[model samples]
Target: MGERGRFLLPKRKKRRHRTAVKMVLAGILLCALLLGAEHRMRPMIETVAAYQARLLATRNINDAVLDIVQEENVQYNNIVNVRQGIEGQVTSLTTDMVTMNRLKAQVTNRVSEYLEKQTMQEVKIPVGTLIGGSVFSGRGPLVEFRLFPAGYVETDLYNDFQPAGINQTLHRIMMTVKVRVVGVIPFYSVTADVNTSICLAQTVIVGKAPSSYTDIEGGVSPFISQYDYGLQAREKLPQEE
Candidate 1:
């Protein structure tokens, strides 16, 4: 109500104004601090997001590379298997060819041998001055009178002979025969023996000297004789025929 009260009131009002101003300044400082914090946090969030994207890209690339590598390995394995199969087939074909060649050679050799043997079995006897006879009274007697120049005889001795005076003669013969080589058959060496009887009582004996009589009585005798020809005669007989 007086001058002192009025002065205090004015001073108090001025103090209140100063306090309000300070509060306003503090509010502005708090707002700037919050804005600065928000700006800094935004950059950190972007950096984290970029790092996550890079990680995802790196993972995807690695997975794709792994898939490609696995595929390549599978292809390589398949190629190797195919190569092995081809090599095996080639080896088997080569072996079969060798076996077939061997069989062909064997068959050829057998055929050649058979043909050679067959060729040797066919031969004709040479008819020449061949003396064949039986023994009569310890001397040689003409049993088979065959003129070598006129008759054609089978050298293999496979034919039967009709004697001039005898009815029949049985012979089991093993002869050592010399045959001239022709083609596939070389010279054949044959051995044969025969049992023959002569009818000397009905036939006349020839080709023996009169003075070279076997018996003192000068008569024919029944006997078995073995005759052998020389190699020269055997060779010449085939050539002449």
Candidate 2:
């Protein structure tokens, strides 16, 4: 009976030791599962962040284009108003044309100055031009405006109209602004041109007009004579006009 009891005791202790080892192993596995979750979750978070960044970059570039267009419109409005006011105040019939000519010079100078000011501004790309990873995943190949003045001038003449009065003269003021655009992309770049023109027509009844008023947006009947000095970077109106 004593020998039998000794044998049973050894077997029981051995079983307890094995059970403890298994419990320790189970605890280790649970801890491992919690810590390893970071490996899977971190990558997903990074990918989402990258995608959001790409979307923001796209929006910024679009906004940049809009900002440039708005700036050009404001400058043009200013030129037209200032020129009209200056000429409208003139009392001499001869001075009307002379004032308009002077106004052209001022417009040219204004455009030149605007281009010069823009040169000081650097076009910004909100996202770093290049993203890492495969080609499809990366953001690169961007376009930013580097507008430089090609030239600007006032042109067009209309002398076919009858004089309405002794002092009042009708005329059209045409302003053209030409700018160059550079497409900055990774590993390659290209340049393009954009041309925009603004037309201001004035007809004073009981006054004299050099001719009729014509515009890029077509004339108000009775064709007007137009001439200009500047790069016609945009689609030229059909010569028939």
Candidate 3:
């Protein structure tokens, strides 16, 4: 009876050790699968999340600009002042500091509010889609993820003047917004930074175009008139006796 009991005890011990080894191997395999899935899904996840965030952010910014424009009755003249010389040439273009600043603040506040209101909205993507093969794409269960502001929404209001046609310069009031968004999945999350610009208002100025222009958006002027080039060339030429 004692010898039989001893043999049974060793058999039980071996079985338990075997079970533990199997469990450890199973755990390692599971971890490897998860890691591989994560790597494979990263690009798809980022693309989807960024697209959703950009769409939402664009809509919010447009809505905010539209609301402010309607509420404040903004116009080209209200935001910009153009000075003309005796020959009806555009000499200087100046922005109304008070109006511009006020509008900028209002836009920033409204965008922030809109983003906050939209943070709860979620985007649904299928697991099969993340797998990203011709056979498995878009064929599996859906996963829910949401976008929220990762940081403060940045808003910039500025002016852009471009030549529209001969002797015509188009003055545009532009707004650029930068939003950092995060997508939260079940156990994974991704972040993206989206930058977008919209034209709030524009007007065609009918006169001689300016030689150079400057704005808060850029230090160097984007528009250089041919008239200025001609003058510079003439000044550099040797004087006739």
| Candidate No. with top lDDT | 3
For candidate 1, write residues 156-209 as lDDT tens digits.
211111223322222121111211222211211222222222111121211212
What's the TM-score of every candidate structure? Answer: 0.23, 0.28, 0.76
Q: In candidate 2, where is summed lDDT lowest over 10 consecutive residues? A: 228-237
- Which residue pairs in candidate 3 have backbone atoms (N, alpha carbon, C) closer than 3 angstroms, thus clashing? none
lDDT per model vs. reference: 0.29, 0.39, 0.72
List model 2 lDDT by residue over 1-241, tens digit each.
9999998999999999999999999999988986675453344334343333334333333333344435444322342232222444422222234444544455545544444443322233312232334443435454243322222333332222233445433333343444443333233233444444444344442322334432344432222223210112111211211
lDDT of 1 at 219: 28
Which candidate should be chosen as best, given TM-score against the real structure?
3
| Higher-lDDT candidate of 1 and 2 | 2
* Candidate 1 Cα misplacement greater than 4 A, ranges: 53-241
Candidate 3 lDDT, 124-213, residue by residue in tens: 889999988988888889977765544468877765657677767777878787877765555556676778887777888677545563
Please give the RMSD of candidate 2 to the true structure.
16.6
Off by over 4 Å in 2: 1-95, 124-173, 179-192, 203-241
